[model samples]
Target: MTVQFYINKFQALKPDKSSGHAKPHKVCLLLAVIEQIEQGFITTNKVIYNDNLKSRFTYYFEQLQQGNDKDTPYLPFYHLQTSGFWHLDVKPEYQEEFSALKAASNSNISRYVSFAYFDEELFDYLKSPATRHALKDALIHNLDSLEVQYQRWALSIGKSEKTVKNYVGALKGSISNWLYDAGISKENVLSIGSYAQYSVVASKALQIEEFRAKNTTGNGMYSAALKSYQSFLADVTQVNVKDDIDKILNDENTTATEKSTLVNTRIGQGAFRDKLIQYWQGCALTRYNKMQFLIASHIKPWASADDKERLDPNNGLLLLANIDKAFDLGYITFTEKGKIVISPYLDDYQVLGISKNMGVNLNQQHQDYLAYHREVTFKK
Candidate 1:
């Protein structure tokens, strides 16, 4: 595959940033380098001489050189060299076995590539079991196509067919073992006609297994598995399964209610818990840390909102008891810039005690949420 393809995939994984330190570009370049190395497109020896590789490296290095005022210089070159990219120095004869061992070891070199250029939080998330599994599934599904592309590339670079076959076999075996461990069945593995097909199946299996794990119930894994299978059908087949699932869950006519019960229990528990965790057990507006004092106050009232709007964190706030009550009653509100807005009925003394004590100046980060509250939730 061309460098652009890898760049696009890596970009999808990046967290959305409006401004500030441009950490994503560094990460993108680092992953691109590792990807090239893994596919044997660039070796430690060749990297120093290749004009394309040098140009890419120079772009990131220049950004770093610009200093912290404009962008944080997350220098990844030293980390990359130290963390095994340099080991591509292993003779071409041993390259096949080495690549196989590297993949099978689950050293998470790709994640390390990310770490060399991003923040600690991203590194931690990538190492997380859920995220790691997702990435592995994606990589496994793409491995065959990558290998084929690499073969064509190697031929252009004057590599022999024997070496190419050996490299491809090693990559396949390593990735196959990874998929098997992630719950893909041997039958499905054997049925695949090509590496690309195998990858698609493995990706589906991982998604289904993840969804099921998060939704398991007394009816057994089978029911949750079926739900996940249905979701995959909706995604791959584009059949709009949400309405179908919703109808079953909401059907007043159903005498048999297993599907409805499972759907409600899963959606309520999974989504609510995720929202609570994201807000870090506090009220967003009041900065209320006490669990009992905080409520996950929805921006749009629950009854009036759709499922997507109701669950959005941007549409939710952590508010303390009295503040939440005041907000709901429109007795007090926040400005579009995040400053507290007391209702006309509230005296200055009361506003001073609450809003001022809380240091409620509107910072840039909270502006959007404040705007939403001002436009949609705040009382006049």
Candidate 2:
């Protein structure tokens, strides 16, 4: 349970080598747990198999995955019990049934296990940054050696080391250009102050003419690299909001009129939409006076908001259907100055009638909600 004891355990993980390459699944899961701990998402030793942890595991899996390796986080979550430090807490009544099973499948694990946890000592050691770093480095050292071997193999096959180095730098350079184009400074999250900003920034970076012009390769290598990076980060950082309306609709005690009002507010069909219409006097972006063509969109997503934020006129925008969809999906956002900041990932903006010059009419009341949109909702 000491630091070195845990370090040795992490380094000596028994990954499947039947295919001649380590599966990387367990190591990736451990790395994801460490990341979640650092991010304050996994506060206690009990590891709930939630979307955040699953997404983080998938992120690391993508990073280290070799040929033919499939993403199956549930495998490690259950099988890690054999590794001594990890343990699974099963449902009380299902304990005997779970014990009788020889193999773990996703559905069975979900039904049987309440959560997983580490040994008390190991969990305490993981709370230390130095301990976490040492343990992670031990796990990653194997991956590093594999990369070195791959490089040597490439050289033996007549590919120069310089070509290999440039191939590696392609993704970094592409990502740098994306950050620059999105007005985010190198090494800083800028005004938004979160990784959530990367969602929209990655999107806008793809749309930048200079980015496309410089990074274009005949086979789409650079673009693919950018997308790969984007995908990994988005998976790690994106917040999954459960639909609040669904929960309310399922409550049998709730009255029909209340359900109707909530549903109407959600779809911009009720008083909330009426308020947005009156405030904007038309489309918030285009000032298009036609009322029927606009949708009332929440700046801070409905599921993540309270009742006040959900119905606040200042928290809403009356946008055209296309613009509403883009904004809802985080492909389009507005600056504090109200100018349009489109995601590079948004394809065919010209066809959709969206432009860089578009802006929304804003007041002081809207600033807080807009800030939430830029930080958490925007695709940057």
Candidate 3:
């Protein structure tokens, strides 16, 4: 449906001329939209004649433009209504007027026909990266835009195509939107390997395909990649497990004292918060003093605790959720000596907004739990 549909439909493009060259202008415009889709640029289907389309059309036009031919962007852009792959969208008031001129020649068609769309099947087929590339190959192979040598050259190299497309997408497409001052290149990011290997692609493959995490928990590559990407960004690994204490507390076999101290509503989660509110007025890591934004995250972890340890206010550290999630997931841990110990797995701690000076004031009792977490749970 993908390759055959494009070839058959595109090869049938009726040239306005009775003589020399058959300009593949409609195909070129279709290629422009396909390029936009592949780069994650266009969200919706309507190809509005806005700045985006104008710029894309110009880029493709320059690449495909040939000898003695003037820049006629509006030519096939309007005339493609005859082709099965595209149709014009005019205003309701212009419906009668539009239908009358639907079969007009290049010069007769108005530039005011500002919107066009791909047929539904053609649009859906172009959504896949691999399929999109194959279709482009078919277009150029049958009736090319550029010279055959340049087309073959583009198809031959891994580095050159990768590098050029990376630069183009970054400068003018969805990558620009994605990177938005993030100060990282898609080339460098793609070279980062499995961890951050484009979350969007991994997400679609994993969600629909039921991909599993390699050497880790959860289903799909996402479980691993997302955590890895986050770790890559934040410089520490994270484990997204359900709250184990909640599971233990719900067990009927669990003793009342154990259950009592683990329930969030039953003086467990709130009581720890109350104690922390009294003891430390700010987060240990950033000294961020907003109580509303702080969490009473555990040092020893609740599932590992006995009743006394579970209820002990001193066992918890007041950290912001940003820091707390990191602490909770073992990206960052504290020493018995109260110094912040970031995991070695992290690439750059600064990227995570974690200051080098992060620490907590600890007593003799808090030191014991910190030691256990540092040894057993810390990503180290």
Candidate 4:
């Protein structure tokens, strides 16, 4: 089928607006998945409704969701099965949840569906750059005027980003901080980028009832945060990696394991391994280019990556086994600017052959995942 055929179908997702104009949450989610595929994040087409997909979808929803008309990823993903191009796989365990859904009018659909998928033909076609870009253009053009209005206004308002970011932290304060200091309350993916015109006042405060009343306009944390950084992100220029990548490739490091990973590309397999062949041919931090025994390790463990992230080449690195073990065990991290950071309390400092002066070669994507590794895995 023609790309326009798919684009038309994608832009026609149903909208249910009880209090205000409908928002295009489905279109946004689809766009997020498409973008993930183009960026080589999703290796498989199984669109599981997990935190990773939600976080990725949040990137698009922050532009469309408004006031209490929340954008729940499950709702859009679950309902997409009605569209011939999408499919929801109902597992045996979800039988009870499915029964409960049919009994209630507005029941949560995700409780009944374990995963989602796209028609193979449609998914394959969307993988093309020309096709993906065309559909993304069609979706972006579909946002309602009101949604566009918020996006525009959000861009113009200026406020303390730190204040908005610290809202949850500030609310929990010293008391709750100590009580559940390690509570596993899931972290919401927030847009901490910049925004435009904002209220610098203590005028009439907004109330829940007041804001929820039909046609009352308000911005949520997601929308506001996206607006703050939308412009900045759009204007960001990519850093060149040719020199850095070349240095690693030419380094004396040559190993059998890394070589195997490098050439293991078999009709869609080893995409990340291929990236190790391209961007980084040697250890990420350890200048040990002597690749006689290097490992192709995933920064965000392969077992944990969502659809697209697992195959992201930038997420993998070539490292000597010892350095890889140290990094894999949270003993070290890399700064966003490509500096090596060692854990504060590593045992047996004399051995391990790890040096603090190890040079690093990475691009923005590498830096991004490294930040995640540092936050959740690094010892310090």
Candidate 5:
């Protein structure tokens, strides 16, 4: 769709304002336009009408010339395209400028874009810290299958093969521990099959009324599955490792000595060790070459967990002294799906400084651990 058409549609969608401008309405219209474009419901060519171009331009021009809200200005067609109108390719400088505009507009626009109206509540569910973590766990627990699912999703989204491969590989390594959570069971979930089918099943499972009307046991299972998937998404977006670890450490079940021993013993053992080797074969966190200096740090507190649970590989990460200390001490942690979660408890400068020093980036391999850490360790 052409930019002018989008503007008209946006204006039409907005509630009629006789006097002052409707900031909220305008923001909602912008969000709707972007969302429609993202879902392929609208295109650049269609946005600009071939015959009514003049009329369209005239309307936007009139709005700009007579609009009450001077702060929220409308861009001309050239400005919109040059400013990287959503999907259209633009020069690097224009892209940067567009990014700035988007950033500025995001908060206002996102407020009006309700997730309740979407086909699936997946994106909305992902907004939660716990749900994101659970989703990460689900993805990691079903890593091999999830990778294929991700590829399928990527393809459906029109991502290139190389991009799909990279995303799948990165997510696999990062969220390895997601499947190991206490409540999740292998029987309830399916992996190697079609993602579209899985999504359908998942959606069906989430239909509370239908599920309840069917078998009670089946309903429970579906509820559990939905919860697990929601948690996985939460892990992806919001799980925090350090806070969870701190909670574990402070739990009445654990002692200071046990905490220390837990830290010392599992720093390089079994699954944890293997995960560390897989994630940072050469210690990406510390850049330390010596194997002795590298250690697999647990996202959850070992003292708070059973021996078997502590040994689970999904609980660990390979790190150097500073990074390990930060993770262990709750100064730093990762989101459920390997995204870095800087503690608000720390100074902004400290967080930024540490992040710069560590050079950490979210990868698929860390998703499992990141989810666990977010669920069990992150503060909030």
Candidate 6:
């Protein structure tokens, strides 16, 4: 009935562990439900088995599911009843069938269950952002163990124990200390709901007085730690972007014509995005380090580039959303020497966060791309 009680329940979900890693179905389902609630889909206590819910569930599944884990939303939908909070309302005529069922399948659940609802107290707790964040943090804390496994792997690959320890300690210590200063939990800052918060904390934590004092090796110590952490995150959290694109191209569900259109829309998703992320390490023009908020923008417009030029990392600039929009629409460009070149017509460039002081780092490889952008993409 209480928020802490539900948080405890979420943290202790009994997921299948026959596989080396716990199957992600139940947790992914919970995350999907929370997202739906946040997006106003689950307005009341009733939870419907709708397309939006299924789509979100599958999205999380793709992100979290590892070897041999199949996408089965129906399993969690029917089985979360055993968790003591999720209750299913089976139809009147199929009550006997629902009761007799040992396991659930999509077809049977569709036929027997009308909807699912949370226990009333639990539903009210979920509606509040703070409690929702707490619940999500509790669920995602499961990933902390995976970080341990990553450390072991790092050792196996000949990384020095001290080096690895400092890397881990730098990230964990800095973030936890920063959060404590901000009145959030001082411990387990690693599982703080989303990657955006983690990146933001890491950025702010770099400036903590204690950290600055100890970072006597210039930017080497903490910068190396942050990069290693980023690599670890990409390994555990992301699928190979190129492989994902190839799957879409090879899917039998889409015709060649449709595939062409789809591939164009997916231009930024391939190795280009990964390269930009690695190259910029953060936004090209700002201190914001949230990866999710950054856009991998091509300096030369994609439509104008040949195949070789389109995927080239040097042709890209990792930018914040507003900067990406302005650059894409030809309201802004940059000079060969990496200076900002705002279009004369864009009178309120300041409103778009485009300051006169803004510039990017450029090298010889970027010259051709910058020239093309200034000549063709710049408005004036």
Best by lDDT: 6
TM-score of each: 0.27, 0.45, 0.38, 0.42, 0.27, 0.53
TM-score of 1: 0.27
What is the TM-score (0 to 1) of candidate 4?
0.42
Model 4 ranges off by over 4 Å = 93-100, 103-112, 150-380
Best candidate, TM-score-wise? 6
Ten-residue region with minimum lDDT total, candidate 5: 110-119
After superposing candidate 3 on the true structure, give the runs of residues whose Cα lies further than 4 Å from its correct spot.
Answer: 1-249, 253-261, 265-268
What does candidate 4's lDDT look like per residue over 232-270, in tens digits? 323211011122222333546646454333323211125
The local lDDT score (0 to 100) that residue 88 gets in candidate 2 is 93
Error of 3 at 297 (Å): 0.4
lDDT tens string, model 3, 105-158? Answer: 434344445567788777777786546545655554334322232322222211
Q: Note the clash tally of each candidate.
A: 4, 13, 3, 19, 51, 0
Per-residue CA lDDT of model 6 for 1-380, tens digit only, reads 77999989988887887887778788888877876676455789888886557766765665566668887899999888889999998899999988999888988988888899999998888888667767876776553364574464344333457877876786677646655776644656434444445566667666677656666654567766665555444433322332344565678987875555445434444456778898899999885787766777888876677656766889888887667767876777888788888777454567567788888888899999989888888878
Could you tell me the lDDT of residue 266 within candidate 6? 45
lDDT of 2 by residue, 271-353 (tens): 89888987889888888887655778899988778766787888899987657767877778888889999886565566557
Candidates in order have lDDT scores of: 0.41, 0.69, 0.56, 0.53, 0.41, 0.71
Candidate 4 has its poorest 10 consecutive residues by lDDT at 196-205
Model 4 lDDT at residue 29: 80
- Per-residue CA lDDT of model 5 for 313-345, tens digit only, reads 555666754456456546567654444665553
Clashing pairs in 3: 211-220, 212-220, 235-346
Q: On lDDT, who's better, 1 or 2? A: 2
| lDDT value, candidate 5, whole model | 0.41
RMSD, candidate 2, Å: 14.5
lDDT of 6: 0.71
